[model samples]
Target: MNNFSSPKIILLEGIVNESGSLHFFEYSEALPFSIKRSFWITEVPQGGKRGVHAHKKETQVLVALKGSVKVSLEGTSGSKHEFILDQPNKALILPAMFWSEVTFDKDTVLLVLSDQEFLESDYIRDKNEFDEY
Candidate 1:
């Protein structure tokens, strides 16, 4: 029902039939940015958290392949957005320079799609370091 107040939320097109349900994205059309790398995060213990950082030059799309995820994004300007992604067709778009924290529910699997490859120097892992930058 579109509970997210942030415009970063994107609802992907899905098809359901007797076989099952399918959700897909076209790189040049549906996605806001082209994908350069993709990865999956799973096996997070209870009350587990991740992504307490921000990127310097990367944008990402977070999708819940299974279960659910609570995502909180805060910009340097003190603006914030919170989202709960429970459906496979729902995704949250995170742009560069916004700090984010993702908390996972039990048995949740998160698929992350990035616009850039993994670069150590591009990560602002410290909240203080991110704020000072």
Candidate 2:
């Protein structure tokens, strides 16, 4: 798909009370796709990287749970974008066919929600392969 759009960042609804704060997500209201798998990235060393690939049929949303994260994306049309996720209430939506690179700050914990399950055929891990995808 050459008509890929930019990544979207949506603010999730949160409630703050005298005790603490709570944030929740529902597929019908918060995400564009239903969640089929979920995971987290944590204990990343300084200057480390993750997500140096693109999914062919999976859409994902990343939420920073502890620290900050920087996400860089490149589309098939050669467009590039960058975003910062520093709040748990904020979610970054990543559609398929976009190469992504993620950098984490100290103690950063990133929660990833995906619309598809793990499939080796769904991943494009090389930049050249992704460009030709």
Candidate 3:
């Protein structure tokens, strides 16, 4: 995992896998805040990319299910680090203010859990202005 100061990025473990039964775990015990929405990305192109922005108040957890993905974390000082997520049970917790980009190796399924719903004003898309902020 990459070390981050402002928006703490943590790798979470212990995700269950069932053969025949389907179970839904409560997010109240695991997360600090309630989960407002849930979404997943499964059909990403080989050379495609996503999430080249940062949120001001939202926190997220990303998981790689099928293939692998390289997450680049950009700081305000132009410092950067990359993390490869391949395991189904592992997740990366991303806080606000950290610029992130996702690049998939082959067809990848990326699951994202958010603390809030979709809000356009919360996003900082410009990389230069994102670095300045």
Q: List, residue by residue over 1-133, the lDDT tens digit for candidate 1.
A: 1122232888888899999999987754446466889999999985699999998888888999999999988887888889999999998878888899999999999999888889999999999988886
Best by lDDT: 2
Task: Candidate 2: give the clashing pairs.
Answer: none
> Per-residue lDDT tens digits of candidate 3, residues 22-58?
3233544345667676788877888678899988778
Which has the better lDDT: candidate 1, or candidate 2? 2
lDDT of each: 0.85, 0.88, 0.74
TM-score for all predictions? 0.91, 0.93, 0.78
C-alpha RMSD values across all candidates: 4.5, 2.4, 4.2
Residue 122 deviation, candidate 2, in Å?
0.3
Model 2, runs deviating above 4 Å:
1-5
The 10-residue segment of model 1 with minimum total lDDT is: 1-10
User: How are the candidates ranked when ordered by TM-score, highest leading?
Assistant: 2, 1, 3
lDDT of 2 by residue, 12-123 (tens): 8889899999998985544656678999999998778999999987888899998999999999999898999999999998988899999999999999988888999999
Model 1 spans > 4 angstroms off: 1-7, 28-30
lDDT comparison, 2 vs 3, better candidate: 2
